[model samples]
Target: MGRWEPNARMRLVRAAIDLCAEQGYEATTVAQVVERAGLTKATFFRHFPDKREVLFAGQEEHAALLTAGIGAAPEGVAPLDAVAAGLDALAASFSPEQHEFSARLTAAVAASPELQERDALKTVGLAAAMTAALADRGVPDPTSRLAAELGVLAVKQGFAAWADGDRDDAGALAGEMRTALESLRRAAATLG
Candidate 1:
């Protein structure tokens, strides 16, 4: 029983999410989270630099896998399609059991202004990483950045919908993201 105390970092996230779900994200304090997790500030600091960062843990491997997926995409595949596929492959790395906890964490992120700002910064960083990954595959400037943004946004929206819903469609996040990217294409066509 002592061996399974929610992995320290996950305990903090679970505590924060529970507090956020019960009250509001802004209303939840680090102290409250630590208290609920039966942990100290030292343990919290060891896991995350701050409260908002607790939600963004373990993204390094996701980026590495996404880059590899893009690099391995067939030459004929378009940039957006490649990105969609990459994100799908990334989603495949996580299991459905992780989805429920992650969904609550995401909701906590959405509910907090500080976390939302941090989330935006994280998205920009992800876009840059995607752009760099695609550039290595011979894709060019503005298009690469735009496609990365669109692809990630789609994945975010799709995951958000699935996470908030009571369905087993979290795997649908990649395809939903693809549809979002297509919608952007249609909208751009309308504008021009």
Candidate 2:
């Protein structure tokens, strides 16, 4: 835990989650997080604006991945299919180490209303990113929004299942997400 260690951002995130889980999100402070990370306040600020943000540091990156994935879809691809590609990209960014982190994060968020609100906002932000990406591809209004919603739902459901299931099988998050998306599609079809 040197001052200039690599993966400083991840260190801070893990420290924050650990502290929040041990104590409470409301009880945790930036000072404690930085201290736990063996990093300075400046380093903490460099990675996150505040303690709350440490829990959500990947928001923008995840959005970017989703946007790029959707944008990279083949021309004339269906909206949901584009969303699936985006989800795949997002899921690919996760690593096995993140499995425990995700489980801790879920518990931390569940225990705190503030963290829950931030988590909800994160979901909305991701959905909006997907919606905008789909719209850019000439998808119409409700369709774009609906597909985005489905993508978010898939991500949530998939992540929960992955986090709760066997850690050794954590790599199945992407498949779980895709499965959720397909299930949603099938359920929607039944409405027709």
- Candidate with top TM-score is 2
List candidate 2 stretches off by more than 4 Å.
Answer: 167-171
Q: Candidate 2, 165: how far from true, in Å?
A: 2.2
lDDT of 1 at 67: 80
lDDT of 2 by residue, 106-184 (tens): 9999999988999999999999999999999999999999999999999999999888878534348888889999999
After the best TM-score superposition of candidate 1, give how far the Cα of residue 95 lies from its true spot, in angstroms: 3.3
lDDT of 1 at 63: 76
Model 1: per-residue Cα lDDT over 1-192, one tens digit each: 232366887778777777887888777778988888888888888888887777677667667767877777888798977887677777777656556676777867777788888888877777777888889878889888877877667667766766665655546555555666677767766876
- The TM-score values for the models, in the order shown, are 0.83, 0.95
Model 2 clashing residue pairs (backbone): none
